[model samples]
Structures are given as C-alpha cells and as structure tokens.
Target: MKNLVELDKNHFIHPTSSIQQQQEYGPKIIVEKGDGIFLTDKEGNVFIDAMSSLWNVNVGHGRKELAEVAKQQMEKLAFSSAFSTFSHEPAILLAEKIASIAPEGLNAIFFTSGGSESNDTAIKIARHYWRIQGDTQKKKIVALKRGYHGVAAASTSATGIPEFWSMAGRLMEHVVHAETHYMKGTQIAIQSLREIIEQEGPENIAAFIVEPVQGAGGVIVPSEDYLIEARKVCNEYDILMIVDEVITGFGRTGKMFGIEHFNLQPDMITFAKGITSGYIQLGGVIISDHIHEVLKEKSKGTLFHGYTYSGHPVATAVGLKNLEIIEREGLVENARVMGNRLLKGFQKLQEEIDIVGDVRGLGLLGAIEFVQDRSNHQRFAPELQVAVKVIEALHQRGIICRPVTYEGVDIICFAPPLIINQYQVDTILERLQDAILDVRKQLG
Candidate 1:
C-alpha cells in the first residue's frame, strides 16, 4: 500500500490539478474512504466535506441504499443503448421520474455519460432545431462572460472562461459571449447583454445560454430582474433560451432547477452533476415541447447524436434511487431550510472578517468575496493567490472548499452536501473562520 503511494507519486496524473506541483511536492490528497458528510484520507486524517466532492455528491457519501439499487440493476442489465431499436425498463422509469420532477415544458430526456457530453448534445440539438426551422443563420450561442457549461468543444465555447478555452484558441464560429452579474451594478450586466445582442444582431443569434445561479464562475447570482429582461429580449428576438443547469439542478439551489427559482421559461435545460449525486456518471438534457417537437417532427438525420454510455442502465437506476432519496428524505426542503442556516452563519464570518467584500447566495449555495481592502472594495492582487491559499489551508484543516478565481475578486464558495445539519454547519464555520483569519493575517 505504501508502494501504491510511491507509484502514484511517481507516475499518476490528475485532472484539474497542478501536475508539476504534485511531482515536486508529492500528492495533495489521498482520499481513502467516505461516509455521509465526511471523508478520511490514507493518512487517517478526517474532515467534513464542505464542497460535496466538487459539488456533485448531493446525497452525500456512503449511500449504501443507492449502491443497492445499482447492484440490482447491474444484476438485471448493466448497459443499454438509447439507440432507436433498444429499450430498457430502468431508462423508461428514470425518464418518467425526471419528467415528473423537471420544470414545466422540459419533458423529454437525452442521456449522456456526464455534464460535458450533455452540454455537447444540447448545442447540437439547438443548432439542429434552428436549421430544421429554416433559420440556419440562427446558430450563435451566447453565454455570460463568467458562466461555466463544460469542457467539450461546443460547451467550452459557451463556457465564458478564457482559460478553459486554452484547449481551443477561440470560441467556435457564431458562438457568442455576454456579460455576467459580477460587475458592480445591474445596469452593466443588462447593458452588456443588450449591446452584444445588438452587435451580433438578434437574427443571427440562435440561443442564449446561462446558468440560473453561476457555479464554477464564482456562484454569482444575478439580480432578480436580469433573467426576466433576458427572457423578454430572447422572446422579442426569437432566440432559444438554453439554461445550463449542470451544477444547479437536483436541488442545489433549493429548487429542482435553478430556473425554477427565477420564473423564466428556457427552451432547454442541460443537467448532470447532481442527477445521480456522483454515485454514477449520468447527465441529460430536458427539452421544451417546442424544441422537442421540432427535432422529432422536422429534423431528419440520426438526430445525429448519441453516446455508447447514453442511458446506461446502471447509471439510470442509481439516478432513480438518488431522486427517491431526495424526495422521500425531503432533501430539497432540507436544503432550503438548512441552506438558510448556512447563509446566516456565513453572515457572521462576514461581520467578523474585515476583508470580506460581499456575501451572497441562494438555498445552500453561497460565497464570500474577499478584498485587499473592503472599504475601497480593493481586491487582492491576482498573483497573491489569496483564495487558492485559503482553499488549501481549509483542506489541511479537513474541509474541502473551492476558491473561485474570477469575477473581479476571489471568493470562497460554500456548497456542502445538502444533507448537512446546523451542527455540521457550525463545525465547518469554525474551521472556515480559522481559514479566513489565517488568510487575513497573512495578507495583512
């Protein structure tokens, strides 16, 4: 087992990590086992998992019950294609379950292996739908400047982060980018979107993609009126409204979908992370009736889309069970109830810490923006890597959290497993306070 660490130290490469640092400093984490609300590393260090294992483990770790569902489905049939000819009971059941819970007009489901593929499927279907409707020029996808969709080519174009685009030099043709709410005022966000739409010409625009509550882009929650205005503009312009709920779906923001909280109608909703709570790889798009009918009735060709892992039976089974747990256990309402508690507790940290520039969130998803000098709203210099340091310090204390590096300032986002209670919240806040104080002290 020690050799395993040695081998990993010598040879393993990890995703979204500093490869050079790992080689020089050794492995950052050696997670061994996890249970509800907590995890332990190979060194026997234990801590509350505050970020829900990158914001997907909603039902929390060690869900033996969900495992049972997977075992049962695997026993019967493990993999099945959504390819036109084949059908599976678990897929049918999971679709019905999804349709029952998703927002109105989002009826049909197209499965993928995970969030990135779901975003890919979404963009293709959008372009195909426009082409089917005889509006080939309506191929542009506009996303907020700081929004995150996924890493696939099409998804990356819509992702809004210039860094994520390191894989591709520029956005794919006709894929547009817009302004996010991170700017100080609402007028800027509205004006930026309007100007971009006008410059691009609404006629050329096919879809406007957005995350109801921006997640990876720093959990920026738009003003109440922003989406309403965007919805009106899209309607006036005949552009499809695509809401990427990959992070905010399945009750992360106190609602089944973050759009549900905003009261806006989106033409499509892309989802994945929370679908099976990361117990299994599963993702899918929720299609509005208008788009669904157009693609089903007018579109020719193979729908020209699918993955070998699409609607994998075992994944669907776990998703179904994950949904069951969310419902029977009332985790959604629990998140709403408990999320408010977390927000309230976070407010205390804001009051106690002078560096905190702002604190904002919805349901259980919240963040605190740190500044070099809050009185002037002065941000710490980017090279200081203050947020990154805080995240690492928090991890050392056993709480996993992320520091969002964009949006004018750095932020530490709190999105624990929706299953957390007040006791756990307090415990986490205590460690987080220490982290906050440490950053403040070092920076000062």
Candidate 2:
C-alpha cells in the first residue's frame, strides 16, 4: 500500500485534484474494491459512496454481470472502429437501446469515448448542422452559468465554471454563459438567455446547452418551467438545444434522463458516466430526428470528426449489460424512492442543523448548502471552509461525498448509487448529521 501510494504520488497527476494536497497527504484513501454502495480501502476501511464516484456508477460497483459481458466481448471482438462505415453489433445494439430509452425524436447516436468527448462532438455537430444548412453565421455556443459540460477543448470552452477556464487558459472560442437559476426567479434566467441571444444576434448562436439539474454546480435544480421556457426560446431562435446529461443521465435523477423530469426535448443529448455504471468508459451524443434528418440530408463526404474509440466493442457491451441490469433491477424506480428519502433527510438536517440551508435534489442527486445564520441565510466566511470541514468529518465517519465551493457557494453534494437501499440512505443522513454537528462543535 505504501509503495502504491508512493508510486501514485510520483507518477500520477490526478485529474481535477489538488496537487499540493496530494503532495502533503500522499493519498487520502486507496480504494481497493467497491460493492453495491460501499467502497473498501486498502486499509480495510469501508465507506459509503455517497457521490457515486463523480456522479456515475448508477448501477453500483462490483457488477459481475458487467464484467462478464466485457470479458465475452473482448474475447470475441475486442475492438472494431465505427469509422468509415465499419461498425460492430455492440455499438449498433447499444445505440438502438439508448435511442429507445431516450426522449422522443432523439434516435440518432454518435459514439464518443466519454463525457468530455461527447459534449465536444455534440457542439461540433451542432455547428456542422447549421453550416450544412448554409447558416455559416451560427457558430457561437451559449451555456448556462454553473452548467458543467466536460473538460475537452470545446467542452471546456462551453463549461460555465470559471476555474476550468483559468486552469487551462481557455481552450476554445465562441462560447458564452448566461444566467442560471438565480434567486430572483427562473423568469430572469430565461430572460437572460433571450437577452444573450438578442445581443449575440440569434443568427450567430449555433447551440444553447444546459444541464437539467446542475450537478457539480451544487445540484442546483431549476424551477419546473425553466427548461420548458428555455426550449421554447431555442425554438424561437432556431438554435440547437443541447442537454449535457453526462452526470444526470441513466437514472441518476430518478428518471431515465434528467430532461425527462422537465419534459423537455433537446436537439442533442450528450451522455456518459452512468450508461455503463462506470464499469468501462463509454459515452455518446443522441441527435434528435430533426437534426438527424438535417445531417443525413446535407452532410457531404466524410463527417470529418470522430474518435479512435468511438464505438469500442468492450465499452458498448458493458454499457448494454449495465443498462440491462438497471432495467431488470428497476434501479430507476429505486432511485426515485431513495431520492425522496434523501431529500427528506436533507430537510431533517435543515430543521436540526443551524448551518444547513437551501437543501435541494432531484432523484439521487442532492446538495445541502451551508449558511452561518439560518435566519438571514448568511453564508459562512470563505476562510471558515465550512463545507470542506463538514465533508472531512463525514470522510472520517465512513461517508464519502463531494464539496462544491465555486462562486462563493459552500455546498456538500451527494449522489449515491441507485442500488442504495433505505438503510443506506438513512445511514448517509445519520453520518452527515453527525459530521455537520462535529464540524459545528469544532467551529464553536
């Protein structure tokens, strides 16, 4: 274990992690195995995977069915590129399955390796769709503030988070952000989108992208009508609406896809993470029938954009088996039931804990914002690091979660595996309450 930690520190540059913290603490926990909703470390310490390991793993961990499917696929046909009309059964079947489950009119699938690539592909396709229509002026992409797409070049540019841009110094051009669900109201948020389109000249805007429920941005669930209005606005301007379902897709939000919760149909839906329950890397963009028709009718020789692992047989096979498990076990319904319990737990925490404020969630995705004074909803000082401390406390108590500290927000996020039971939900809440109390006492 020590050697592994040393090697990780020396050779591994972890993604979206603090290098200084890694150097100071080596590694926080060397996770050895995962089963259901629990992860076991090399030191034999067990933890509740409350964040579902980056909001994926909808079907839970240690899925032997997924493993067997992967093994069988690799033995039979390890990989066959989908490039140049060369396709495999796994990709074809997986795409068909996804289209059947996806929202209406979204029938075409463009495979990518993961979330970032999925978003990039969606963005490019949106532009290509407009270009093929001879609307070359439609090039700009508008995303919502606090919306997290992914980290690829175009995806990074489209991401509304500032830190992601600051880290890489801006990767792509022609990307802008509009107001998200602000405290004022969803109307104002909708107005912000309209205003951006008007100002940018709707002709210059190719796509308007957003997440149904903001995940990394603190699980901010917009008002019911927010997405409906946004879709209407996109239709008004003839702009492609792209829904980034990388985190919210595949039962993470109780529904099959997060957009289903709002009854909103998008031009394109970029998805990853839960499709395979994190058993293997796989993601794709599902295009609406309208967009598909446009691409099919106008696309000339060679689409000119694709990944080497676009239709990897092993990943797609694992995804098919994973989806089968989700359907057979009814994990989507389980997510809805467990999500209610989780929200109720958060409400309980809000009533009991003075610092707990603005608890929100959809399906299994949830968050609890911290405030110094509940009466006025005054946030704790940034130096206090209240969210971080509370999460650290939870970590000590065998509960794993995530902390979102972007844009002056002190929020602790949770998205446990869909396979999590009532007992596990209560356990997470109980430990979270204890952790918050412990941190409160420390602060006092």
Candidate 3:
C-alpha cells in the first residue's frame, strides 16, 4: 500500500506496457486473491477476470488442490533430470496422462518452461527430423500472417505479426508468412486454403504452423473448411502440420485442443499456458507417431535439443493433474455451455452499442470489436488508442479484460477460466458492458 507502486516503477519491466506510463502511474491495481471467477484487489474490490490472467489460468486461481499437488511433488523428489537416463515419477506419470488426453498418436511430450521455448524446440526438432530423413530442402516453414506463436527467434519468425518482428529482422530464414484467414480475401476467408498451398509451393514448405483460433492476433477463428483444406495440402506435399495450441488448448476454445474441433490431425502440437494454468511454468510439444518414429530412427545422431528444466517434475505433476481435473470436473463441457451464454450476452450489448463491430469466440474465449461506424464497417484510427482506453476503463470498473490491438481495429478480448459458471459469465459481461459505456463516453 505504501509506495509499492514506487518499488514496481523502480524495478519490474512489464511486458507490452509503456515504460514512461508505468513510471508515471506505477502499478495500477494489485490483486490480493482469486477464487473461481472473482478476483479481489488489494482494496477488497472484487471483479471478474475476463482475460483469465493473460488468457491462461484455465482452472482459475486459488485452487488449494493444485497447491497441494505442487507441495506434494516438492516433498517427493521435486527436482529430477529427464535428460540422459534420469527421470522422475511425476514427470513420467504426467507424460502418460498427456499421451492419454492428447489427440490420437500425440504420444511424445518434450517439455519446456513456457510456450516460446516449446515452439522453438518444435522447429529445431522438425528441421532435425527432416535433415536426417534426407529432406534438408524442406526447411521452409510457412505460418499464417497475424498469427502469434512466440517472441523467441524461431517461434517469433513463426509469429505472423510484423510488429513483433520489427527490430529483429527475419528471425528465422525461409520462414514465409501466408495470408491469414482473418486478413484474407472474402473468397479465401470463406473458401478453402488451397490457394495458399499453390502460392507457397508445398514442395519447399516444411511445416505450416497455425493456431486453431488466432489468439494474440485477435481471436480469429477460421472457418472449419480452411483448416480442413490446410491439412489436405500438408498431406499432399508431405509437409508437417504444426498446431500452436498455446492459447487454444486445455478447454479455452471449448475442446481439449483447438485442433480437435476440426478433422485435421497435426503432425505436431505445441502447448503451454493452460497446461499448468499459469501457476507453474510448463509447456510441451505433442508429436504424432510418424514424427516420433522418424525422429527416433532417422535422427543422424543425438537430436541435441532440450532445456535444463525440460521435464521438471513439479511442473509436469501439476500439468498432469490439471488435465485430470479438467476432465474429472467436466470443465471443458462447462466452457462450451457458458461460452455460449457469454457470447449471447455480448451480442445483446452489440445490439445497443452501435460501435460494436464483430463478436466471436468459443468456450471461455471470446472478443468484441469496436468500429467507427458499424454500418459502413469503418474502424477507428490507430492513433486513438481505443483498445487501451477500454482496458483502462475496465480497470477502473474493477474487471480485467485484454484488448486485441491491430493496426487500427479494437477488439475487447476475454478468455476467463473454464471453471466459470453461468452466474460468473453474466457478471463478467455486465462489467464489460459498463466498461464499454465508459470508453464510448470518453471517445465522444
């Protein structure tokens, strides 16, 4: 309470926040506790966490059982090496559980500290697999524009937004970006993705990495046919389909993995965030049977790709149990139901709010865009900082929601925990509506 803000200003370099602004205002609100869908601030003001702590925390905060799981692991062989002949019980069990819950044939799990590292690892493994199989020419990786993979060199190259890749030019060579489903021409948006395959020349393309629903790129959920067509193209050219499930996995998009919603089976799926629900850092790459075999047999020698904490016992233990609880408590099904409720609630707001442009989401993940004129589909100017304004207004109203910022478009994004019920859903929508009104008044 006493200049904690000053201390934060002195230290803490916040991600995606203005350094000058933080020095001026310091930390906005410090949350003291979270239970289920409600988060209580230091001042005891409670509100819904609409963004689910940067779109992770699938199980929500303050799960005593999860704490116990972490504690138990700490008590029983907390640290162990998954590298070269050493393994831990929790890590092994967690791997088994992941194999069971993941898509058919995603039996191998290579761990990482977070999504960025997981994706980086995936690219290395993919290239390694190809080179050993005498396909060194297949190093060309294709990703969708406006896609958000990670900020690391390799994964950042897979990231579609140029804003993330500006200072660092061409993080990964031969990484070509294709037209995203959201930014595509109408026919391409609605039609299949065959044109992309034709243009990129599938022979030179090694992998096509995509998110089931583009997360940081504004929750852009492509049509089912688009993903289906992509899978066909990958198969035709023998290209690996890498589904970056960093945001869409673990029931946020209503399914275990976003790829599960479609018929396409990815050769590799990189997962993070929800695996440990933002408690402990945890992530992994789920590889299909074919890739696994190729990786094992055809590898020139040692694959030589891993982190010190690749399969940290504590993280894996929590991740395994997290999946277990999501299944046992039927949180995924709840996300589907409550997500519909949240969507309808937003649509009702869109009816009254002339500025609202589009509203789309699944399960616990959703968002609504704001435009200058809905009728003409005119967007507000990028200089206006509309999304940032809405986020600040929401903070004032006590709820926490993230805004997806494009070149000029403002989309209010929400991906609360899957554990939220209908009542909590209503509360989140109500607070968001209030915030939207405040932002509109400010703009006027």
For each candidate in turn, give its C-alpha RMSD to the true structure in angstroms. Answer: 1.5, 0.9, 1.9
Model 2 stretches with alpha carbons more than 4 Å out: none
Residue-level lDDT tens digits of model 1 in 144-250: 88888888778888888888877556557778777787764567877787888899998888888888888988888888888888888889888888888888999
Instruction: Write the residue-wise lDDT of candidate 3 on 11-127 in tens digits.
Output: 899887778988888876777998977789778898778788878999989898889999998998788887785887877888788888889988988889999998888888778
Identify the runs in model 1 with alpha carbons over 4 angstroms from their true place.
none
The per-model lDDT (C-alpha) reads 0.85, 0.91, 0.83
Q: Which TM-score value belongs to model 3?
A: 0.95
lDDT of 2 by residue, 296-363 (tens): 88998999999999989999999999999999999999999999999999999899888888999899
* lDDT value, residue 156 of candidate 1: 83
Pairs in clash, predicted candidate 2: none
TM-score list, all predictions: 0.97, 0.99, 0.95
Residue pairs in steric clash, candidate 3? none
